[model samples]
Target: MADVLSILIGLMFTCTGCLLLFGSSISADVDDQLTQDFKRFITVMPLREMFPWRITSMNYRTMAGVLQLSSALLLLLTSGVLSTIANMVLMVVMGVAMYSHWAVGDEINKLVPALICFSLLMIRLFLHLRHMPKDKKD
Candidate 1:
């Protein structure tokens, strides 16, 4: 059950990452929508305020896409420590996404996806840790 859930999560991330990474290449409508969405996301992200230099929305989106893609690949292709690390990374990403939605004063509906993903990641991590060998737990 855990393995099946992990695969489903991995596929979800893969699709999300691909959409983000190739958003502009897909279609004009998608590109424009992504552009606007990222612009709004950048405005809400704390890192934008913390950084000294100007950071474009596309930069944030690209970085997120890369991270998600890499982590999803690790989660799909590996097990044990590697998969654990990937799941943690995804959790962090989803947490940040939820925070961004809250910061922007988005409605609950907008935050639901991130919240769901975060919950799933937590559950998967718990299951993974529970099944891990006691010796390698440290």
Candidate 2:
């Protein structure tokens, strides 16, 4: 069950990362949508106000995509501690996504996907920790 869940999460993140990183090359429509989304993200993202320097949305998108892709790869290719760490990283990313949507007053529909992914990551992490071996001190 844990293995299946990990694979599902890995595939989901991989597709999401690819969409963020390469959707512009896939189709004009996709590119337009990504552009619009990036604009909205820049306008509403709280960090923009907190930071002094100008940060382009493209750079932010690229960073997000890289983080998701790297974490997903780790989850897919490794096991035990590495997989657990990947799951935790993904959970943090999803949490930030959900928070961003809420902070911007996005509709519930826009927030649901992140909520679902966060839930799944929590469940997978729980399963991993539950099955981990405990040290027996003599």
Candidate 3:
């Protein structure tokens, strides 16, 4: 049961990661609509717009997807020791990033999917790293 749930959770992350990347890629076409919808919540222009906003929904979603996809691929395809170890460090960074998104009061509920995806990626990363050496040795 636990293994099945774990796999399902992982699959969920992969699907959402795809959605996030897809959304970011098409954000330019939907920028106006997205901006208009949340102008009150948005502090500045969307990612599609070339502005100096510190953060944008599209930007966050895009990078989050990139990291999540990379993490997943690393977990699924990694066959060596070093790549697995690197995935561990990335997992920690991604975990902090997931928390940072909500720590600043950006509506945790809105980021639930991304949050779950991050968690799943972290789990995969951990599994890959758990048995690997901590450092490279010749």
Task: List model 1 lDDT by residue over 1-138, tens digit each.
Answer: 679878999999998988889976777798898788788989888767788878889899998899899999999999988999999999999999999889878899989999999999999998888887777554
Question: For residues 66-102, what per-residue lDDT tens digits would candidate 2 score against the true structure?
Answer: 8899999998999998999889999988987888788
Tens-digit lDDT string for candidate 3 (6-77):
355445546645765775466665545543433333343233356555666566656656765665554445
Query: How much is 42 displaced in model 3, in angstroms?
Result: 8.5
Per-model TM-score, in order, reads: 0.91, 0.90, 0.46
**Model 3 lDDT vs. the true structure?**
0.53
- Global lDDT scores for all candidate models: 0.90, 0.87, 0.53
Q: Residue 67's C-alpha lDDT in candidate 1?
A: 84
Q: How accurate is candidate 1 locally (lDDT)?
A: 0.90
Model 2: per-residue Cα lDDT at residue 32: 88
Residue-level lDDT for 108 in candidate 2: 98
- Model 2 regions lying over 4 Å from their true place: 46-53
Give the CA lDDT, 0 to 100, for residue 117 in model 2.
98
